[model samples]
Target: MYYVNQNQINKRLEFLNWLVETIPESLENKPESDKAILFLAQERILHLALESVTDIGSYIIDGFLMRDASSYEDIIEILHGEKVFPSHLLETLLGLVKMRKKLVQEYFHLDRNEIYPLLHELPTTLSEFSNSISNYLKHELNT
Candidate 1:
């Protein structure tokens, strides 16, 4: 059997993550809607992670911690491939963020310039998120 090293795996994960973050975010206003779309995209990435890697490090797959290759792969395929998130999850996330924005706004607040950091970091953050999932997949798959 062939074995993969962690460094090579890390590099691949990094590349995959970079690919994810570069996806366009051209939808209008609706911060919550944007966040919802981003979240769904992240979820889709996670599905790939599970399918692509072994995930021995207890990576959370759809809220459940997955330990084995089979469970991870199953969850990943179910989630990542072929339009998994559908419309419902997007609706739910958008609704929650929209309805609760007042409450969320009260506790977690950001100023105009302060928010800039997140905006500037958006690409990198999404990239890191993808990398994390890719790493999880690589570790689990041991390929």
Candidate 2:
């Protein structure tokens, strides 16, 4: 039997919830002079949010004895295989996984223009991710 750590999952979900709530406000209404600082800050937040997502997914996979994930992309793939989220979300989640890699490995070379558009989608994507995990957990636990 797989042992799901409800508390651990919920804690991560709470953090994800915080990240989703923080993204929109962080992206908007910034002073022109502060653009550089804002970009860096947003970059860090997005990185953290993406990290939290993978962390939560990994936790659930381990708890449920799902197939081992060989990479960050695999983590999303495994969750998708289990129907944790809809098919439409699979590509977006995979893109975020790739973005996480870019944030970590290519930080210095990142283009603000390229990243800025994605930031606009962060809140909605993160919210969808969090909700999917929460719903999956609720169903698994109750079953």
Candidate 3:
């Protein structure tokens, strides 16, 4: 059971929103030389976890890669393991897609259909989810 504090939730949301604006910029400005290093680090971590872990590997992979998932159902099953991922991780993933949906579409010149699967109206969804999770945490943690 996770005990998510209100203060933590607020802080995490703030951090997530800030990162929402920064990540695309980071990827855009990432230097040619550092791109390889960045990918190497990512691959290194993926291989390490795949080699060593049982229950949590897919969670890490899905969160980081965001694709290459075998199936949506498999991802959901992994996410429902004894250790639920921190709620903000889910929120951030959804929130990032939500926040950048338009920008990505414009930048890539993609049509609505192309970006549809990549984004959701998570600003609305996240608010509801945040409240619900907060309520659950309050009840479960008695905090």
Tens-digit lDDT track of model 3 for 2-104: 3233464455544434433433333343678887554434333222222222122243443334334454334433443423345444543332333233343
lDDT of 1 by residue, 1-143 (tens): 32335455465556555544543442224477577565444434433333323231223342233223354334334433322233333332222223222323442342223232333433444454454455545555654
Who is ahead in lDDT, 2 or 3?
A: 2
Q: Give all candidates' CA lDDT scores.
A: 0.39, 0.83, 0.38
Question: How many Å off is the CA of 114 in candidate 3?
Answer: 3.9
**Cα RMSD to the true fold for all candidates:** 13.4, 1.4, 11.9
Taking all chains together, the TM-score of candidate 1 against the true structure is: 0.30
Candidate 2 lDDT over 1-143, as tens digits, reads 67888788889889989878878877787789988888888888878877888898899899999999999999999999999887777877787778876788898888778677777877777788888888898898885
Return whichever of 1 and 2 wins on TM-score: 2
Model number with the top lDDT: 2
Q: Indicate whether candidate 1 or candidate 3 has the larger TM-score.
A: 3
* TM-score (all chains, Cα) for each model: 0.30, 0.92, 0.31
Which candidate has the highest TM-score of all?
A: 2
Tell me how many clashing residue pairs each candidate has.
6, 0, 0
For candidate 2, the per-residue lDDT at 23 reads 81
Off by over 4 Å in 3: 1-9, 15-112, 116-120
Error of 3 at 8 (Å): 4.6
Error of 2 at 89 (Å): 1.5
Q: Cα deviation of 21 in candidate 1 (Å)?
A: 5.9
